[model samples]
Target: MSKKAYPYVLIMPSVLFLLAFFVYPFLQVFAQAFTHSEGGLTIAHFETIFYDFNFLPSLKNTLLLALVVVPAQLCLAIGMALMISKMEKGRDTVLYVWTIPLGISDLAAGIIWLGLLDQNGFINSFLFHVGIIDEAQSWLNYQNPWAIFAAIVFAEIWRATAILLVILVSGIGLIPKEYYEAAEIFGANAWVRLWKVTLPLLRPSLQTALILRTLLAFEVFAVVMILGGSNMPVLMGEAYNWAFSYRDAGAAAAYAVVILVLSLLFTLFYLRVLRVPKEAQI
Candidate 1:
């Protein structure tokens, strides 16, 4: 090979790897969605997916979880980031403490919560021991899926909030002290300072964190499976059930396409609302 050609040869490997691993799979799924049985080319699978009873409900739940978790997490992350950034001592330790739960797998978090909230579980055992209830109340049962949803939300928030915190902290670091001091000198309280000074500057990071958290929440499966049960049925879980339990790849792929569309729409909506000026990919 020519001397100058060696660099192109070395870079070719990564380009090929991305095409083989990422581009190929995405293309295949998209292709499958268009080609179906009993029809050479059609939207049958999409129709079936949309018409399925659980499909709409699952989509609704997925959107609802994202709606609830994203704002709640962003708010909590902002507070934690502010607290961590403001502190002079133990700031490093607190940052690490926040990061510790990021290592927790979804399955592990689900199981831990299951243990705590199970009937005659730690929470109930304590309540019963303390005479808070006359009987062992089933905190997370089938009839009441909200409690299970709550557990899933808590587990998700506990495990995922740290990443958002880190994002905000990095944003906080990028902010100059002059803005904060100026706000203070103007007789602005903490809320006013946060809304008027801090949040506007934190926009890019907040936008990123929001998109990441919301997308992840849409694909919430492992935790829901482990804690909420397959019967409880979140969007991803229902997709998994269709794909694996019923061995329906066409439907599964269609569901995946639906999720992809929803995620993209959400991200675009957020970017538009935030008025992100550049189309920079992060």
Candidate 2:
């Protein structure tokens, strides 16, 4: 290959990989969303999902979950990352312990929390033993929607906050120490340093982490499935029900397309809001 053509030759494999995995699947989902069993184009699937009893609730629950969980995770991750950043000894050990949940799958984390929160599980058992409750509580029951929702939120945050932490920690590490020294020399407090120096410099990483986490939050399925089942409606859970339980491929594809659109929208929003100038980036 000519010198100028060598770069394209090197990139050919990546271009082919994206087309096969991402581009093709995306187009297929879009096609299926509009295609009917007879192979004619139709809006029946979209109409069906819109009219379904579960559609609004599922969308609301999914949005509420992300709205609640993402902010909570961001706050927790920031505090955790800041603390870890300040540590002079055993920082690696502390971070490793905190990130252990990252090694667990979503379903596995749900199951673990389930054992603790279930009626006959550790939480209720311990509470009963301590006479805090006279009977085992059904915290994960469909009757207590709040409890079930809280459980899912707890599991999700516990399992996923490590991701944000890792990203933020690396971002913090990349920030020049001279900036912090100068702030300290100016008699700035920790809070001032965080607000002025740390966060401003960390915008790019924050943008990347928030976009990635928000997208994954929208696609949350396994945790909700294992924890709340059908009692707790989420977009992904509803999509699964429509596809496998109801055997409606078209409806499932519609759900998938909606998810893709929402992910793209949030991604664009983050990019726009967090647009760091090239000169400002480290």
Candidate 3:
């Protein structure tokens, strides 16, 4: 076989795998979202989800969580990556410790946080022993939505920042050391070098990390469900309730579509904003 034909032949299995799994399932869900049970196409499923009492709150919570978590994780990851990049010793050890959370499943992480933040959990127990509170406080409850939100945000940051850090650290390693030397010779301080040399060259990695983290943020479910329950509604949680609790597949598909659209929009936004010129690429 010709070389070009051989390349396509090798990729044929992957192409078929995608068609059988991702593309096929996506098309089915999309069709289910837009079609009526009676036969004809209709927007009834969309309308049902849109008019549901929980819809607005779910959308707001999802957006707010993504807005808060993504930026916080990004900032923390960047700081950690820079620190690791500059470390003269035990870098691998530090990186291994930091990335331990990546091995943890989302539900497991949520459950772990729940054990800490529950009314009778470690935080309240510690506070009680220290005479800070007379009793175990109900932090993850409907009475205090803000506390629940905070717990979820904290859990997410703890669990996912390593993802961004690993990506950024790899990107930083690719950068030529001579660039920093030149910047230093020109009287650039560490902060100035970071801004001028590191960030500009790191745009490609930033775009990748942001887009990935943002998409996962939009689909956050297990952590929110574990930490907030019905006290704080989120898109993915609502979708699960509709699909399982309410037994409404169409509404669930509609919610999935909304999530897909949001992911696409933010992905496009990052692509546009962090567009790295070909000339600037390493």
Q: lDDT by residue for model 1 over 1-282, one digit each (tens)?
A: 899999999999999999999989988887777887665887888888788888877887777777777788888999999999999999999899888888888878778878888895799999999999988998677887788778878878887998899889998999899988999999999899999888888889988888888888889888778777844677888778878988877788788888889889989988998764655322
Query: Model 3 segments beyond 4 Å from truth?
Result: none
* Residue 85 displacement in candidate 3 (angstroms): 0.9
Cα TM-score of candidate 3 = 0.97
The reply for model 2, stretches above 4 Å from the true place, is 1-15
Q: Write the per-residue lDDT of candidate 3 for residues 88-107, one digit (tens) a residue.
A: 99999999999999999999
Reference-based TM-score of each model: 0.89, 0.95, 0.97
lDDT of 2 by residue, 1-282 (tens): 689999999999999999999999989989999999899999999999999999998999999999999999999999999999999999999999999999998989989998898887999999999999999978777788898889899999999999999999999999989999999999999899999999999998899899989999999999898889888888998889999999999999999988889999999999999999888777
Taken over the whole model, the C-alpha lDDT of each candidate is 0.84, 0.92, 0.95
What are the runs in model 1 whose C-alpha is more than 4 Å off?
1-18, 276-282
Ranking by TM-score: 3, 2, 1
